[model samples]
Target: MIPEEEGVYVFNREARSWVKISEDGPWVPKEDGTYLAYFRNHICPGCKAFDRVWEELIEKCVDKLHAVPALVQCRNFFFDCSDRTASDTFLLFLVNATPQVIVMVVEGGELRYVERCYGFEIESVEDLLAFANEARERMRKYAEEGEAESEEESGEELVVEGGNWKEVVEKLRKLLLEGRNVREVCDERGCRFVVE
Candidate 1:
């Protein structure tokens, strides 16, 4: 059975356990880690074909990564937005097709989107592994960049370019809360300061 979490849940045949996933929700990611999310449904033949590939990939790469598989049920393109489950998560991620895999990263307690691997693009387990490896490398680079930024003085000003000043201010505030050194934000043309 799937656990009561704000994401998707899929049975890991290899592990013989249900793996909880955080595709899109209030659920936080594993501390400073990466999660591989598989979005698919039982009705889609493509999804079924990719399922075997996913299983094999998991069997081979389980020791090297954390993967979550979800079997979503979406009929007539309608989803219950109020519910927080695999179906709802599939909608949240704008998944219109089955067998889509996304990589998510947790940095500073916030969940961030990394990359995605579509089922049609995956021909074998090795393809999946390569995609996952690339995502992991990107996450590593992102973490390193964030760490380097945090080491700098917090008072350093940041020029945020955007058409919506209010939105930019809100984003800058969020970045500041996330331990980013955002001293100020301005419009793209630098006509006025959005936040200072």
Candidate 2:
């Protein structure tokens, strides 16, 4: 479980909304625990549309996964885009898009990114539930195996410039998640993406 001091924003099941748990740096759970995080921007239409189903998922996942729910609002930064304090948190999670669902696990104070799903892919509460179940299974594996390698560790770093968030997300989803070797500028304005 996340320590009270480290819990920055938590989901309130009764209110069915995100609540500020503490004014802290990084804004992610750090102590040993299983966490479900919703990453979004202030002005994203997809994030707005996902609210209802996200609330439903929170209710279901709390009991089913035994995971604490968290929220990261990426307000205005170009790359990381989280509200003032959580920008580093977004970068730490490598979230390049709004409306992303991530599952994180912390063991012995080490944080690991376990699973992720984009909002568009989650059509209903059931989809989110499936995502949660997968994350739960992965977390179990991590605990049993002792420090399994994460996606962030396996992939090379990507540096993107001049692209809109949507385009960057699409390209990254393909390159990273789908394991495609396709390389294309992410925007009409001629963006540059370099994998190093």
Clashing pairs in 1: none
Q: Which stretches of candidate 2 lie over 4 Å from their true place?
A: 1-8, 12-17, 21-24, 59-61, 77-82, 139-196
TM-score, each model? Answer: 0.55, 0.59
What shift in Å separates residue 164 of candidate 2 from its native position after superposition? 29
Candidate 1 stretches with Cα past 4 Å from truth are: 1-7, 10-16, 20-30, 66-83, 139-196
lDDT on C-alpha atoms for all candidate structures: 0.53, 0.58
Colliding pairs, model 2: 74-82, 75-83
TM-score of 2: 0.59
